[model samples]
Target: MEQLHNKNTHGVVRFITCGSVDDGKSTLIGRLLYDTKAVLTDQIQALTKTKHARVTASDAAIDLALLTDGLEAEREQGITIDVAYRYFSTVKRKFIVADAPGHEQYTRNMVTGASQADVAILLVDATRLDTSKSNISLLAQTKRHAAIVKMLGLKHIAVAVNKIDLLNFDEEVFKKIKEEILNLANTLKLPTPQVFPVSALLGDNIVNPSKNFNWYQGPTLLAWLEGLDISSEKSGVNLRFPVQYVARQDGSAAEDFRGYLGRVESGEIHQGQQVTILPAGSVATVAEIYISNGLNSFGQNTSVEMAKAGDVIALTFSEDVDVSRGDMIIAQDNSSDLLTKQLIADICWLDHDALSTSRKYILRHTTNTVFTKVKNIIQILDIETLSQAVEADSLGVNMIGRVELALQKPIAADLFDESLATGSFVLIDEATNHTVAAGMIREAL
Candidate 1:
């Protein structure tokens, strides 16, 4: 029921770079930060230290990787082991860039990055385009990461053909790579990805135009990113505000000061608006809305006429209604007919142990956790082929599959394509209490 709009007053665009190992993801992010002059003097000075290895041979030059590869272990190995997030701003917009690990073992980390991204930069190494050998080569991680980002619902994808310097900035090589990427996108039914020939290490066609590639006339990566309409991608289609706590101001004068505290995941709520409480459809009118100073530190209760999606506030009802933590308050205008206990979901298995139907796990949706069991593994998707292996019994580490989940209690939810906030859930291991899987509801059973 939330109205979709464009351009948040703050121009922030969140994106991620992912591909095979040694594909220069960290370097690309580092170069973006460096070219934008976002790095500080002390950080630049630290890069000159003997321990920080520079990518180029120049003594005065700094290795851009040092700006992102923060961990000691990652620096020693010269690889990104986890998701490295860096914030910077250009003249046109602010940016949050996530440099995801390229190794196949860290696919879960890539998924974490993809979950929050509005756009994705799929990096491809120029050297990996070699096709003269008898055996054809494919970057498995690149394909896998592409599938993961697409599956996670990112519509804007940019294919950066990196390391063009190594190929002498060959126009034909760029064409070949671009064509191959287009073919792959077509096979996956993904939106057409804009291709750019870039050298993250050499700083070509990233923040500035590359003089080397005369044939390339499109906007630079930064320019393209600045031009994107990311406002519509910030929130989902439905209103979902899950109550985290209930604040009661008990006093002789403030007798009517009882409020439900929560962050609006999506959609907006207004004062005197009619709202429905979910899992128990009780209707109530919002008497007052108060924006708190902090999550726990509620110093000043600033009364507001309305609260938009993403605002953390408290709602006082006109009529005293029984509401508690884990309950949801949604707009009464939600049109989805879905209200069920069984769901068909697409899941990314993150646990070391495979997923089994017989085992019970805790399914956490919004703030509510309930017992759940995997009733059946319908199919496992092959990332490269874009084909499903029908009738899979279980899912292994990093494998993506569609399964039937039986919940102990019924929930008011929506299709993932309808609303991401209400249609997603996480599977937690009973024994280790670790998040073993992340899932998106495809449909109700």
Candidate 2:
């Protein structure tokens, strides 16, 4: 057995397991954690003693699903209701795994988990599918989840035909399922997904290959994950820094010390880099960069020469420009034009109440929030057929649709396909202060 290590040579890979309810999503995650020795002995003992533990003929097997089904309701009902996240690392790579709920009502929860994931491991229950039919119909929940992930721009997808052991590890059944999955992907315009036949319960073809199936010849699920190239698409892009806070040393010895504090959403910022402040359209050079040490009582910050994406730092400009909290800073030379008051976006309706076009919503994108109205409900997407319906005027809860939005003012944003950080926004109900929808900008109209 390979020893588990905390250090990783490759960067972290965030993935989510999603499928219909009772499809063994939780079991697959638990098996990965168990095989990698991520779970402690005490946790294993607790699993065996739990009332929900699965009983075998010889002994009470450790209920691996219990490792991620942490909520009381989840344990009592034996279903994942909310998204549960777990972290584990190997010598090759680090992983952050999310176990998403599979129910139709909780589709919003699954979207939340998939938004941050680099890859999605879609679990399919082999026993529940009928292979005798010429046209195999997948569960509605499965199609919905798959569509949502594709809409979210997840480039990598893997289908795990789970519970293969129930069919006596039959190779023909696995092939049928794999064929259906490919058809589904082609219909959704998604890239070809890597398919695997595995038994999450018995831990076959997950971390290690099983001798039960000699015909199947593919890397184990863990091996494929470890070898994936997780290099960010954001690399080589121009800088995009959204100003969140403005810090000033009023009583310090040095006068005119103004720092714009926020995270570098993309690209890099150097000390002498020339950047343009958006909306205001003012150009200034970066004078100094200070890496924020978080909240300190002494108010001391370490000055740095440069900062890259994912870094939260304070930047000082050469000129005293009128920079505000909601302003964005980008490279002046190569940045794309982004100022626009109208936008076309794809949205996932998340509220209990249906979307109303006349109602006004607070559109929060990055550090900026603006009042906006839904100008038009362009079309509603049919998840089953992957088609668009233009007749719908209103969108119900957990629906995905395209709409045109009219903002109060122009804001700097990129297309969702170009930059997820700047192109995504959430619609908030003004009266209830509840997030009603999550939107991705498709075009600046």
Candidate 3:
């Protein structure tokens, strides 16, 4: 029974807004911030002074897009180019919101934001979906972003049919768009997705229910977000603790003060538990555990009975075992066959320099960086058709592909579907040390 302090803290939910250009990703986020009363007085004053502000006879409205589109170029062009993150909290939950770029050229920026998000809010302009002919589908970016979200393994999705106010809150128009989105979700085999009709610019059906939409009995966007169960999503993972540092004291107490300091990436660790150290294949018993209290600070070294996922803990071992930074501390019962050299992964190319099989790059996972090379370009994914091209020679910027990699050493890792924290990595350019690509492990080869 670990004396774990207040678990009553409201959990943080990381979510992203993505769609085609002019789909209102930035405005949606700005609405969330303002309606929640998270905006400061000065921020409001700055928005009011901007030329882009929209005012009504009865009330005034800021160019809410300016809230997330902070770049001068973005504001001038009225388009988002980079991923913008905003943090706010309600009584029920805290939120870390990301406004992803909606342009086709900035697909890489959207991928970067969606990779860490727990849920995705896919926005669709209601005006686009009001098709007189029944055959045409939604925009290309709408479908492309949905496929990428599924590949990233973000199971929870919220289809927000935005700008419904443009349609005079027409129920028939909302139903048509909802049906089209649901059809797409079924084709992608996406999990149960929730749909909401919203007007981010007008703040309708966002934080508060809209009187204009009397037919909609669904929860508001904020309410649905608050009701999500994030803990269930984190359960059933294996223990993976990557040692960031070895904590040592310099006094008589130092004799017994050999502790491995790191955050628990997944699963639970308990006192008296037998653990295995990777690469070395050594075994040791967990002697005691101490959880961090604050920055550069620690609580009293108490003998915690158990520590679960997301805890930043320092633990001492009963027996001496060789360990250092980059070493993994996994429970003995959870050990699996580790991959030593070759692996197959899904990669999203992020650099101007195309991936070349002839060049050696740096592969970084967790705390380890190793020399690696692209062995084979198996296939390139076509976002439009959601199919693969078997004859790809190289992966271009913003292209998604499957590739085989040869590493200098092995890494203790899991399939991306099984464990997100340990299964993802980045490729770095050896010369410039720039992040060239992001990868999610499919399996060991």
> Which prediction has the highest lDDT against the true structure?
2
Clashes of each: 0, 0, 0
Instruction: Output the lDDT of residue 266, model 1.
Output: 81
Where model 1 places Cα greater than 4 Å from the true spot, the runs are 1-5, 8-10, 52-60, 133-137, 233-238, 298-301, 335-338
TM-score of 2: 0.94
Tens digit of lDDT per residue, candidate 2, span 381-411? Answer: 8877778999789999889999999999989
lDDT against the true structure, each candidate: 0.83, 0.86, 0.84
lDDT: worst 10-residue window of model 2: 1-10
TM-score of each: 0.94, 0.94, 0.89
Candidate 1 residue 119 C-alpha distance from true site, Å: 1.0
Off by over 4 Å in 3: 1-10, 52-60, 248-257, 299-303
How many clashing residue pairs, candidate 3?
Answer: 0
Supply the global lDDT for candidate 3: 0.84
Position 320, candidate 3: lDDT: 80
lDDT of 2: 0.86
Candidate 2: pairs in clash: none
**How many angstroms is residue 348 displaced in model 3 relative to the true structure, after the best TM-score fit?**
1.5
